[model samples]
Target: MDFLKLPKRTSGNRTYGLTSIADFGTPIGRLTNILDDYSHIIDIAKIGIGSAYITPNIKKKVDLYKEYNIKPYCGGTLFEKCFYQKKIPEYLTYLKTLGIDWLEVSNGTLDIPLKDRLNVIEHAKEEFHVIAEVGSKDCNLEMDITKWKEEMQIFLEAGCEYVITEGRDSGTSGIYQSNGQVKSELIEELVKGMDVKKIIFEAPTSKHQMFFINQVGPNVNLGNVKLDDVLVLEAQRNGLRSETFYLEDADANYVNQTPTH
Candidate 1:
């Protein structure tokens, strides 16, 4: 039985539907190995938080992803550093020089005023397609759902591409309960009036993955996915995973046997 339909998405270079990979300094050769195998399954490769800065072979990594037709975006923490140091212009310029076509502007770690955040999004939009993030790294900073939803709306209006929900490197932080499950009530609240396509849920673990996929569907956009797990995630998208898809399979057969004809 057909239990899942992977993102029969609008091809690569898509705006709404995207599969992003987080590069945790996997060697360029490894990147090529994965890309060569499933380039069509991947969309974006984010060099998570200045890892490339330490690696220093930035150009080679950038070329490899682009060659495979994967758009490369930098983590927002790197952008935050540049913004805090008043080097926003130079950072934006440097991103262009390195052949980075997409970027993330987030205040996950710092206090960025609304106007300033919009300016950063606008600034990035001039050259790079920007995915603005709307969550704090500090869980103590209580999340105001209404405010976050409003800010996401404004971002969409301002020509930004997506509003990435925070999952951090470890999915146990913001939005997710300490046990690594997303707060179901909060997720209902967040998705209420938002365009589901524009909100990227960061489901880093299998539990988080099941929660979000069960909450939404196979088409839900997820982020912070490890480079190695892209195909696994894709399998989940197709109900190829025994745990998630098997349930979907049973349900399908049950429905088929129901009195219809």
Candidate 2:
């Protein structure tokens, strides 16, 4: 497939430019179909927020992602549930059973102490690739960026491979305002001393994703993407979409070429 040349982007299985999507309630067959053509742009498949419990052929779905080089993992809500139920050990074992190699740990819905959160990260790292998420899911809650940065560092040191800034599936909580706008000030402060590549900004919408891609360049790692939006997001990343088409300076001949039937 000879296509027009485009800007260089990071490869999968490595790091940076990562695109993680949520598989919330999608059946295994439909999930396979989604990944069949677009898995090349997807880095991870997250069974969003406890939806793993009800997914049909869960193990089969996990294996299918692995078949296509896409890592499969659970959302942080499953971890929060196990923590509140005092079944973390059981949860880990269950993930093992499901063949999940990645895990997301967050206290978005529950109030967890820093020490305990770090401990959770420390332990989960032993058996899985951990992604530590920091921020509250409640739109009414406020957080200082300085504190957010410090906590992210702590989680990183605790064995987390990547840190996710909480931007809930609705794109209205955490790093975003209740109205779904990205808080540029907070983002500016959060990246002051942090490795932007090691951070996965939870950008669930095109606007939010475009903001990060533009502000941080095309290699910014993004998460919580919906299954239907993967290729569209890739288009934005590669400047193939209208929002970012200016980044590409196509040859006039190619741009003006007539179509052949």
Candidate 3:
């Protein structure tokens, strides 16, 4: 494979080209099967939404992900639910009991004030690696571009390990329009003068994945990916898929070349 030149990927405990899968109560056996084959390409596993709260054998599931060197965390919606119920302390205890060391702090479905959100992130950093999410899940709720950048910067400064742009599992909110088309201008503006590595764009579909790969290069972090799409996404990242086969760095010498035979 080394003899074939393709887009290079950041390998071995990758800081970029991260693919985070959303697990919606996947049975342990199936999860194990997936990890057995694809753990190397997966960086994180999110117990999607509030399912982590009631998933059977939740602790074992979390431990299994850790065994494969994957950081497993409950979705931020669970955290927001706890916040709404004034059980933030209890939620942290629950996560610790499950042996999960990563946390997602998001306000997608809630209207948590900036001050409170910052305080939550600052305090959570003492116990867990925090990933803060920006943008609303509600498609009709428009967030100003300036506010998006400001909040992202503020979250990073407040000790967030990474900032996530809210493209829900549906791939039709936050940075994307209602029709699932990416707001390209907004994305370009948001990344200007910012460390792209610190931001994980939620790309849950082929179109979104291809766009991010082409626009942000192969090493961009992607989130909210379905369990089955991990291998294909990795292929696209390395220019092995038709959508990204023409990536500029993908051994262009093979293109438009005359055949000696």
lDDT of 2 by residue, 81-188 (tens): 999999998999999998897888899999988888788777778889998999999998999988899999988878889999999999988999999988899998
* Tens digit per residue, CA lDDT, model 3, 45-157: 99999999889999899989999999999999999999999999999999999999899999999988889888888878999999999999999999989889989999998
- C-alpha displacement of 27 in model 3, angstroms? 0.7
| Tens-place lDDT digits, model 1, residues 125-163 | 877888898887775666777887888889889988888
Candidate 3 at 6: error in angstroms?
Answer: 1.2
Give the TM-score of each candidate: 0.88, 0.92, 0.94
lDDT winner, 1 or 3: 3
Of the candidates numbered 2 and 3, which has the greater TM-score value?
Answer: 3
Q: List residue ranges in candidate 1 displaced over 4 A.
A: 1-13, 246-261
lDDT of 2 at 8: 58
Top-down TM-score ranking: 3, 2, 1
